[model samples]
Target: MSIKALVAHGSTNGSTAQIAERIGEVLREHGLDTEVRPAAQVGDVAPYDVVVIGGAVYAGRWHRDARRFARRNADQLSRKAVWLFSSGPLDASAAQRSIPPVAGARRAMAHLDAVEHRTFGGCLREGAKGRIARSLITSGRGGDFRDFDSVTAWAERIATQSLGARAEPERGDLRT
Candidate 1:
């Protein structure tokens, strides 16, 4: 059967939602049936063979709804292929830094056997904040730090790994 993948996200400023949409787009190009939706709009994950969950981080924590989803569906998620992502860091350097998930998310993910957990750079307007906060995040360049190339590559990798199943096996199909 073809893999059914869901890219669900929780975003406040829309950056993380855009990333989720990008991932879903690439997955669709690679032939997996993909759906991108906000976490609050999603219901049961049992129908999907793979799940990609993501959220935005604020104050050293993931969005509350995303964490709740991860915790509430822990069992169903553990039974399927899961990948997690976060988008919070704004500048290029901050994007490259190794920032792990927050405490609550870590607790929820402890048993997920996830394929990977990625953190992508976020985008913020240079003058969105006050003088000091703006200076810290948007000193040099602050349009968008998200890397579409990297995101596409990762989605392609996932498609290759999870999208090879046949809806109906041929008589002698070794893959089946």
Candidate 2:
């Protein structure tokens, strides 16, 4: 059976979309079927075996649509394998530590047994934002800080674990 992964992301300046596509590519390379789509375009999470939800973080919070998507599909999602990712912290220094998602949001995510969450460094495009948004980004000392190797490694792990679980049982298989 082919494993299907739904990669959904929300972005303002498009960095999150880039991150999501990178993940989809990695999963596809591992022999899994993957679809990359925007959070708004993902109508139902029920069809996918594994759902990878990602979003841009602004002001220490995930984009509104991403949060709403999770909430709306929480019941169905809680029963399947789900992975969550956030693209934020645009510099290497900030990427070293775990940056928690918006206050209560992390707590809400914790309730899902099959969910795994990750935070990735993102990019800030020059001249793509208004004064306020630009100012906030600048104040945070932004720059592209994504670690491609790390991202690929994480994707590989998820692919391994999820696919392994779905593998057919063999005679005398220890797991069975």
The positional error of residue 44 in candidate 2, measured at the CA in angstroms, is 1.1
Model 2 compared with the native: what TM-score? Answer: 0.86
Q: Write the per-residue lDDT of candidate 1 for residues 1-176, one digit (tens) a residue.
A: 56789998988767888999999999899888899999888889889888888888766788777887887788888878788888777667544666676675566567676777777887766554446436656566446788878778877877776755433354222121
lDDT of 1: 0.76
Model 2: per-residue Cα lDDT over 1-176, one tens digit each:
68788988888888888888888998899888999998887888777788888888877778776787777778877777878888778677435877666543574366545356788887886664657568856686667888777778878877887678678555221111
- Candidate 2: the clashing residue pairs are none
lDDT for each candidate structure: 0.76, 0.75
TM-scores for every predicted model: 0.80, 0.86
The TM-score obtained by model 1 is: 0.80
